[model samples]
Each structure stands twice: as structure tokens, then as C-alpha cells.
Target: MSKHPLLVRDVLKRKHFESAKLIAGQQGLNRQVLWTHILEIKDFDTLINGGELILTTGVGLQLERETQIAYLENLIRNGAAALCIEIGDYFNYVPAELVAMANAHDFPIIIFEEVVRFIDITQDLHTYIINQHQQALTQLDTISRTFMELSLMPNGILKILQVLHQDTDALFLFVSEDTKSFYYPIEAKKYLHLMEDHCQQLELHEPIQLMSIDKDHFVIIPVNGLGQVWGYLCMRSALPKPSDYTLLNLERATMSIAQILMRNRMLQERQQSREDEFILALIQGEPIDLQYYQSYLPMESRNLFYRVVVFNMLDYANTFSEEDWQEIQLQNVMFVRSIIKKLGFFPTVSVRQHEIIILAFYIAADDMEENRDSFNQAIQQIVARKTPQLFEQITLTFGISNVYQSINSVQQGYKEAKTTIQMQHNELASSIYYKDLGVYRLLLHQDHVALLQYVKDYLQEILLIDQKNGNDLYQTLCVYLACNGAKNDTAEQLFIVRQTLYKRIERLENILGADFLQAPHRLNIEIAVKAYELLKKTAPDILRF
Candidate 1:
């Protein structure tokens, strides 16, 4: 390329300088050029066009500290090559604020005294501009070539990272998902730990970081697709606060790279899912005994039997973005299957996340009991090893369905598993086996006779008060006491007189017995009330009591 390149120094050196004369020595204004007139010395913000190293007469331009600060800020944001204030005209000095802001942003401001022609200084610099333009084009061409070459390959993520590291000089690893701690371990050695943490962070949409493995600055660019972040590609560099423009540039360039990686991975997973379904269908065969699936079971149409084990993550559905959720599905599918394979549960069907179905299926019903310990152990391992918050910390409940001989039998197990999941909600932060979860106790504990006695007793107390006075004593108690005996909370809940509720409790407490009147005595009543929440449908008529 024919060269007329303007180096940073050349930019300052260009232009003919006539004899120097001082204008505003006190105000600290430097003029690089003397135009026929200081036509319009606009700040960088309003100066839309590039390549103008503007000049101004230092005369009454009104350089207040604030005005000077604004001018400097505008120049920095808009890419002023160097600030050249014509000090000879008016102000001779720069304000503390102006100088400080200028130095902070790195815009070089110059000064001049004698009248210099603007055209003489900068008109011939077109050759240098042309050379600069060509060099920029060459760099762009090179990056483009590298981008395309990397994009075409199958291992695009590793390939892109490898290429980027080679060019940019650093280590690259996908980001870890600890946002608060902001840990990022470069190099693939930390893959296992990252996977564990990534699983934990799946419920979150924001960026996460892991340990600072190598003690370098880290940044995560999300690998987002299908409206969620599938993963993040992490990079470590020397620059702590890389400019937004530079980061933006990297973001734009990496979008396609991330898209390719996510798309390729999703396609593979979806393909595997389809293939697994196909194999299950093939195993069941087309001429299935549909009756085995339909009548006796809640979900009857399945041809392949899958015994599901449901473990709820610590996070709720609301926490994950739509993208994070899909990624969760993909990840769970992979993780569960991998675990099963490791545990010698080969060729088993596994479903991930809030599925109407998830299982290790088609094994004989008799085999279910035998596999319980192994499955339980696998689940325990999942809980212990998976990074923080993989299972909903509230309860790590796993519901296992009974094995059915026919694919249709899966519905029975599925229904049972769901019930168990709900049943063992109390055992959050731990796992449960379906048969072991034992929902039958709920039925026994909430039997009609027991429920009727409790309701009838409460009603008698209500009616006795009602008989004495016509207040809706039962309803009032329910609402007020629903506050769990926080008298203030109850009063607030009922939007009624706290004194009145206190009076009602006093009158009712005597009927129930002295034991039920104390501060702690209300706890059993609270339990009974909450239990009623679960049992109300079974004892619908008693609900009024």
C-alpha cells in the first residue's frame, strides 16, 4: 500500500506553524491552527464528522469550569484526535477540571499563537488518511478470514478460542456461573468444576463466575440462543476494564460463533432424543397391547415404559429465562444418561426437569425393588457433587415410579411418582423413592372420621360463641389465626379489631382446654389448620366447619 499514514505523532506534527504568540497563558488554552476565523469550535458530541482537528479563537468563548469540562467530555466520546485551543485569542489557561478530564480521557489538546492557515496544516494529510484506511481494511480482512475459517469447522468453539488466544494472547475457557464471586478458571482443566457450577447457575440468566484459577481479569460472553443463554465463553486478559466499544466488537463477532456452537449442540441433543424415542418405540413394537397403557393408568398411550425419578432443582421456573430452561433440559438429559451409563443402567430412558415423564423404563416390575438402592445412590451422588443449588435447596425430593411390564404401565408409575413428589415436599433438599415416599400415610392421616371429629369439634366451639352472639366466629378465627399466631399478622390479615379476635380466642380457648391457650399452644392449631388445607377437598362438607 502506498503510504501516507498518519502516526499519532504525525497527526500533531503536520501543518505549517507560523511564529508562535501567546493568547490565554493564564487560562491554559493551546491553539494548533489559526483559521481565517474561528468559525465553529463545537465539542466532540455535536461534531458529527470525523477527521476534523478543530481550532478556535481563545477570545470570549466563555470557558467556565463546567463548560470546559463538557467540551473535553464531548471530545473524548466523539474521538477527537487532539484538542487544539487557539490560546492567542482569549483564554490563556485551562481549568483544573478541564485539564483533569482531558488527561483522564487522553485527548491531547495543543496551543498556538500566530495566525496559521487551516488548509496548510491539514489538507495534504489525505494521503496519510488513505493509508490509514487501507491498513484498517487489511486488518478487517484478516479477522474476517480467520472468522470464516474457524466458523466452517465442526469444533468451532475450541477452534475459535484457540484462534483468539493465539492472536489476542491469553487463555480461554467458557465462563463459570458464580455471579457474586465472579470466578473464572481459564483452560479446560476446570471443565468438571465448571460443569458442576454451570448446572447450579442454570436457573439464573445473569452471568456467573468461578474461582480465579490463574489470577487474570475475566469476562464472560454469553452463548445465547433460542432466547436463553445456553452457555458462556469466558476469556482472561490483562485489561481489567476493556472499553465497551471493544467488548461490543468482541460480542458482535462472537454472536455467530456462539450461535454455531449452540445450534450444533442442540441439533445433536434433539437428534439423540428422537433416536432414543425411536429405539424405545422399536423395542415396544407397533402392535402394542394398548389396553395395558390406557385403562388402568392415568397417562396410557405410551408404547415404551420409562420409570421416572424426579428431582426438583433448588430453583423455581420463574428464576430461569426461557433460554436457561431449554439449556437445563439439554443438560439434564445429558447428565442423567451419563450417570445411568456409569452406574451400569445401560439403555435406560431418562427425562430431565419438570417432565410429565422421567424414568428408567421397561425393566420388569420385579426388578424395581432391586434397583432401588443403586438409583437412590446415584441420586445422592447427584445431590452431593452437583454445584450449589442444583436441586432446590428447599427439598431434594426424588420420586421413583414403580416399574410396569408394559410400556402402558409407565402411567401408573408416573402418577405414583408425581404423588410422591408432592407428598415428600417436606423433605426438600433431599431425595425420596416413590415406593418409599409412601403417600398411603396421607390418606390414613387424613381419614374421613378423623377429619369429621376435628371439624365437628371446631364447629361446636364456633356455634357456642355464635349462639352467645351472632358473630361469624368460625370464619373470623380461621382468617385471624391463619396468621400463624403472630397476633399482629393475624389482625392485619383479617383487617379487623385485634381486641375482638383476642376476645374470641379467649372465649374459645376455655372450651378447648387450658393447654390450647398459650403462645406455643397455637402451633398445633396452626398445624391442624394447614393440614386442613390439604384435607379440605376430601372432607368438602366439613370445610364449612
Candidate 2:
């Protein structure tokens, strides 16, 4: 049913207005009449509110030509929808100038050739306006109930959009905060790019905006929840302007969308809270009930592999406020979870201060190596797709633990992941797996004093000589050991000639012994070199003499 407002043309169809004749303003027959009033006073500045049809005898118009003109102008300026005058008493007819003025301003003036009761006309039009209002309220109530019922369905969001589309017969678009767009009828997908481009220009808290795109009009309403705008609801139509009833439907639809979003957010927050507790218990080595483990974990069988991944945001806390930092952590956690899920792994995520921890589950395949490779490749993909769109200046470092088959060993896996991140030395690689740490794994567990002494025992003489003379002895020795004592390879790695390398090696052997490169000594020296590099990165002061 049409819910458009009462217009002047509609008013002319009433019995009380049967004798009425339109004197001017043919262009304004479409003007909406919200209410009707009778005015006998010459002063009506406060009496006329926009969209009221004024009925009167010519008593108010029995003045000079300019006064009559001013009276009409006053009514028009205050937005009276139309003027219905009884022409028998007080004055014989409306002036010619008044008719010309009414037509010019598109302000309707109606004159009754026969006598008509002002009371009957007001009562009839007022009843119609009131009944129309009641009908609109009833329709809105029905629509609201329909939306609430649809919100409980499995595909509630899609169904809500469908209801709006069916009601308005217009294209409906929902653009999420992540820039993902959902359209009704599928063919509306053609407007995806245009909607996204316009969304970028909208402020989060802005009210509904009516815009014209390519000669078609769009009504954009913000879907707000949880103290922020979660997305936008857009309606596209060929009409130059939406009817008030259509706008009401769009508002109702927006509220339903916001309710769904808010409900989902609350459910997710509760789930995340439980997962956080579970992850904390696992990492702290607390005993967990079997029922709790199965509920929170994807443990289809005991043959599955469990691994922990830790992500640390670098230098972010100092840059943002505490509130903003927490928001960033949440955003990053969601991003990591989405990417991990896309790769077909079950991920339980938790955020602790500046770090985000994820416990990823993988079902073991017949080829264990292939399973491990696939997991590693998934991690690489996650790092590659890190949230550059949201936080361009943010840098993240990831550390993965060794795989464990038993839930009891998850604590150890957590320790391994933390160690891999702590002892990380490669600046170029953002992600490091525990098994790839090599000798640094052993060095990471050694006591600081013991590690410092071991480095001193093997390289103390060369370090002191290099410090005293500003020489290349210490660096040359590290390259020579790394190159497996190959003179040509060592020289090339050090960016020096073979003759210069020979001189450095000669000085090195003179300081220590000729057999320093031999089996046990060579191994000890290599361990010392690795220990020294670790200390230089993690504890430079501890390496001092």
C-alpha cells in the first residue's frame, strides 16, 4: 500500500472541498498537507507551521493591495501549504496581484464559488491526516516486528537486507568496516566499487546522507554499535527523493543490522574471554580437565599436532595511548585469526599486553614432513598478509614453537616459542620457528655469567688486541670460523684480498696457538663466537671484561 503523505490534490477530492476552485499555483497541487487550520486574524506568524492548509473568509484580506500581498507572503514564508478562502463575505474576490504572486511562488490559493463551512473542511482533512498517521505507525510497527523476527534466523543479516529490498524495491548494500560489501539480488554487486569509494569519504559518526550518484539517489545510513560505527546501510533508487515512509523503513533496517552486529560482538567477546583463560592455563602449565580441553580444542584424535605461535608488536606501546594500543592489539588478533582460519587451521587466540598468542591445531597427515611444511607455509602467508591497510607503521615479529602431540607438552611448546622470539637475531626475517634457531637455542639457555666466561676463554685475546689497536682481528676470526677455515671463502666474505686474510690469520695464530682450528678447539671457538653475538644483542654490558 502507498504510504505517501496527503497532498493538496488529495484534499480537493473531499466533499467539503467539492465547491472549491483552484485560483492559482497549479504547480503546487502536489504540496503535502500535514494539517488544516482556519485563520480569521490578520496576524498568523505563529499560527502557521509548515505544511498546514489555511482556510478563512476574506476578512483578513480586506486591506490595501500591499497589505494583502504582505499577508499572503507571510503565509507562504511560514510554509502554509495552501490558502482556501470563502469569497462571499468580507471581500468579493482575491486581487489580481495576489493571484499572480501565488502562482509565481507556487503557493496554492483556493476560492469557493459557493459557500462552504470552514469547520467541516477542517474536520474532514484533520481526520484524514490523523488516520494516515495512525496507518503509518501501524505499518512501522509491523515492519519492526518482521525485522526482529528475521534477526533470529541463521542468515539473519542477509534476510534483513532482503526485507528492506522487498519493501523499497531498491538496491540495498551493506559495507562492513573492513570494506567488505554485501548486496541483495546479487546483481547489486555492480555498485561495490562505487559504494566503497563513497564510504571512504564518510566520517564514522556522521548521520544519514542523501547523495546522487550517476543520476540515481542513494540514502546512506551508518550502522552503529559498541560505541562506534560498524558499517553502513545504503539504499539506491531512481526516485529524486525518498518518501518519508521509505526513510522510516531504512532507519528500522539499520537498527536491526546494528542489533545483529552488537549481538555477534558480545558473543565473540565472551568466547574470546574463555579462550584467553584456557591459553593462559596451558602456557602456565596448569592442569586442565579433559572435558574443558575437548570443548576448547580441536582434538579429533591424539595424533594431531599442536603448536604455539607468538606475535610481538614492535615499538607500538610508546606511540599510541593505552586505549589505542589495546584497540590495535584487538585488530591484529582478528587479522591473525582470519588468515589462520583461511588456511584451514583451527586457531585459539589470546592477547596479552603487547603480545598475541595463538594455539594452532593441525591434523597429522601420513607424511609428517609435508604436514610441517604446509604449516610453515601457512605462517609465511599470515606474515605476508599482515594488516598493512589498518596499521602501516606497525611491525610484527612472529615466533613458532616446535610441534607437540600431547596436550601436556603444550607448556613446553609455549616456552620454545617465547625463546625463539627472545633469542631471535635475524633482522630481515619477521617469522622464526623454534627448530630453525640452530646453535642459538643452546646458547639461549646458558647462564649469562657462564656464557660471558666461555666467550672470554676463546676470544678474549683477539677482542682486547682489536679494541686496543682498532684492528680487524676479532671480525676476521669470526668470518674464518664461519667459513670453516677456508682462506679464500673467508677473505671473500670479509671483503678483503687473500693476502690481507693471510696476514690477519697469521696474527690470530700468533696470539693463540697453531692448533686453535683443530677439532675440539674449533668447536669450542665456534660456540664461543655464537655466544658472544647473542650477548652483544641481548646483554652487551655483561660481555665487558
Candidate 3:
């Protein structure tokens, strides 16, 4: 809050006033000026201080209309609380031209009775100003507590609005350069569409300033701290003519808290943004020791494995905010983690929209196959919990990679999980594993880089060759992977009878490899098939909201 001169109204009521401009004299009378906050002076181009009285005879007024306009313009432009023009000089009345402009602009224009010197008003008004300034300061403690409660602690910017709306009794808006609502206390907080016409006077036109709202009835205080404007403050119920100390002191009182809140809000948002970015980076590539997740990793884990679950979200164009989707992903991922933990597999979840990822540590390679069912069941339970019951069209397929001895194997794990999903033969498949993938599934056979590249090339192959025959390829792979490679089970699983299964298997062996039907040959084919399946499922469909 600025420290305005005390008793300015009473001083104006006196025969002579003592504001900074009045004290500076009507014409040249060399004297060092005090008051700094009241920048408004007639043709006063310099930045202003708020204390002292500015007194001018009709000398400033007798100048040409443009000069008079410029003089008054500067005083009002600088945010002078009251303009005192003496009736003794030039004429006893305020100039019609100046009055019209001042009335239209609403810069306070006060005409003293002219029977006394302006200096007499200053002496009388000063003590009254001091008392009021002290009283407003006494309320500081309550203001601080109220501001903290009403404001968003996470976004310090909230403090500014809280002060403006709650304490100062004015609606508040935090606007961006585009004049859109960066934040607002009122729902109807309008954009700055009328800035050029309505609110420019209060505009410091520099970095920060406090000016009265039009008609001199309210103050629009700026909340610019740390060299950035977090937003603006609008104060209501301005006095008919406030003392200098009232204006300046109130400004000074509010200034510190507003700035501190803005700085805090900026810092908090930055932290959240960085945390989100780190999580996203982990999902896109390999997991790392990101600080937020580091403390949460499974302790005493010997071997860790991951399951990559990419949601093939339908109707991306239908959703508007990323925040909503990310929230859904978080809820579902937590649900999946909880279910897996209940079933005794330690799960750590990391996620972003359209992609839900989980890393399960403390399970050895030998235990992976044994626990795979519980893992699948846990994921299924997660879908039931997080997603709405009516969302039957949604699917939650998973890609489980063969357990790797190292955490760096997250890449492979992701690939395998995706393969499990891709090879499934359903338009809306959910909660699947890579081991369930089959022959045309080359993804599991390759490393991360090779697998992604292979899928890209395969898609191009289809596009170039114009082949539409993959329905069978997809089915064969699904059956083989789902049944875990026993020829009888794979055939029985598809319910195709053995001979037809055998023929389809033979065709796959021809395209993928002649050795695919044999022992070691089948082993390599399974890996390639699994890798391809995961890649097909995960890599092809993910998209933005």
C-alpha cells in the first residue's frame, strides 16, 4: 500500500492546501519535492511521490488549452488524488474545457474557496492523515490470515484476488497479455477488452502503479512482484476525497503480501509442470530416478519388471482438457497398483494420458510366469474400479515383457506388454500380456529401437503392397501367444480343430520363417511374434486429446 498524505480532503477544504504539487508552488519557487506516490501533476511528466501538496495559481491554467490539458493530463495520468485550482487566479471558476475532460476522465478536481493559503490546509490536514494511516495498518494481521485462507495456497496468485475481493470488497481478475482470465474471483470476470478506453489511467504505463477506477471511485492496484504482473487489484468504496496518507499508506500495506503471493504461485506452478514433464519423459523412453517417484520405488526388490499399458482412447477429439484425461489415467493406474499389491506383487505406477505404465519390482524372473495371471486379474479389477460402469466400449489391454534382471529392461517390458495387447483379436481388447501374442507378432523378438522401426516399416509394407489379409495373421498370433505355444492348446484355444490350425501355422512359418514350426525355430519365432504384437498394439494407436 502506498503512503498517501494525511488529511488531504481537509487540507483542500482549508484556504490553502499542502500536497506535493501545491507545495511546489504555482510557478517557479525552487523547493525539493517530497511525496512520491502521487505521480499525477499538471504536465508533470516525472514519476510521482504520494505525500505533500501541489499548489498552483492560475498560471498553469492560463496556458493554452492544450498546455492546460497536458498539465491536468499529467496530474491525473500520474494518479494525483485531488487537483486543487485556486479561484483567485485567471478566473474564479474551473475552466469549462478542463472540467469537461476531468469529468469525463473522472480525475478528482477540487477547487478551494481561495480565501486562505494552500499551506494552511496542509498543516491542518497532516495530523488527521497520520492517525488514519496507523489504524489501517493495525488491521494488517487479520488481512494476512484472511488472505491466506481464501487464496489458493498452491497458486500464490490467489492471494491477490483474495485481498481484492474479500478484504477490499472489489471483484478481481488476473489477466494475461491476451486479456483473458488467467484467474478470477468472479465468474463473470471480464477480459480487458476496454483497457484503452476505461482503465488506462490506473495503468502505471510503467511496470507497476495504483490508479483509481474511473469516476475516481475505486483503486485498481497492480499485483506485480518479481518484475512480473501476477494480476490486478480492484478496491471499492473509495472516499469522496481521501487524504494522501490514506491512498499511499493503503497501497504500501497491501503491496508486500501481494508480491510474495505472486512469487510463490509462480514457483508452485513451475514445480508441478516440471514434475509432469519428468513423468512423461519416463513413460516415453526408459524410467529413471525421477525425484517424485524415487522414494516410492519398491524397497528390497531383487528383480524388477514392468508392464506397459497404453490405453487406446477412443474419441480423442471429444475431450477438451488434458487435465481431465490425465486425472483419469492417474486414478486407473492407482487402482491397478492397489489390486496388484493386494495380490502380493509390488506395483509402482507411472502414467500419462492414453498410456498407463506400471513397474513391478521384487518379483524374480522365475516367478513372472507364475504371477502373470494375478497380474492380469489385478489389471482387470483396476478397469472395473476406475472407469465408469457404462464405458463398456473402453478396453484395457496390457503388454507384459519377459522379466528382465535389470530395471533398464523397462523398454523391453513396455514392448512386451504392448505386444500382448496388439495380438489380441478384439476391437476393444483390455488387460492383456505380451506372452499372449503370436506369430505375425515380431515385436517381442526385437529391442526397443528395432521393434519400433519394424512396426513402422510393416505399416508401410501394408500401405505399399495394399494387402488386406492380416485378419488371419492377427487371429493366429493371438491364439498362439494366448495358449503359450503348445500346438494342441493353441489349436484347441482358437476352437478351429487341429488341422486348420496346423495349416494356418504352416502359412505363418512360411512368411515369418521356415524353421518356425521346429523347437529352436519356434522359440525365436515366439520372441519376434511377441515383440511385433506389443509394438503393433502400443505404438500404432496413441494420440493427443
Q: Listing every candidate in turn, what is its Cα RMSD in Å to the true structure after a full C-alpha superposition?
A: 12.9, 12.9, 19.5
Kindly report which residue stretches of model 2 are placed more than 4 angstroms away from their true locations once superposed: 1-159, 167-266, 369-372, 387-392, 425-431
Best by lDDT: 2
Q: What C-alpha lDDT, on a 0 to 100 scale, does residue 188 get in candidate 2?
A: 76
Best by TM-score: 2
TM-score, each model? 0.44, 0.55, 0.32
Deviation from native of the Cα of residue 309 in model 3, angstroms: 4.1
Q: Model 2: which residue pairs collide? A: none
Please give the ranking of all candidate structures by TM-score, highest first, separated by commas.
2, 1, 3
Model 3 worst lDDT run, 10 consecutive residues: 24-33
Report the CA-based lDDT of candidate 3 relative to the real structure. Answer: 0.50
lDDT of 1 by residue, 383-443 (tens): 5655442333334456777655455454456566666676655432123555564334344
Query: Could you tell which candidate, 1 or 3, scores higher by TM-score?
Result: 1
Candidate 1, after superposition: displacement of residue 284 in Å? 18
lDDT of 3 at 126: 51
- Cα lDDT of candidate 2 equals 0.80
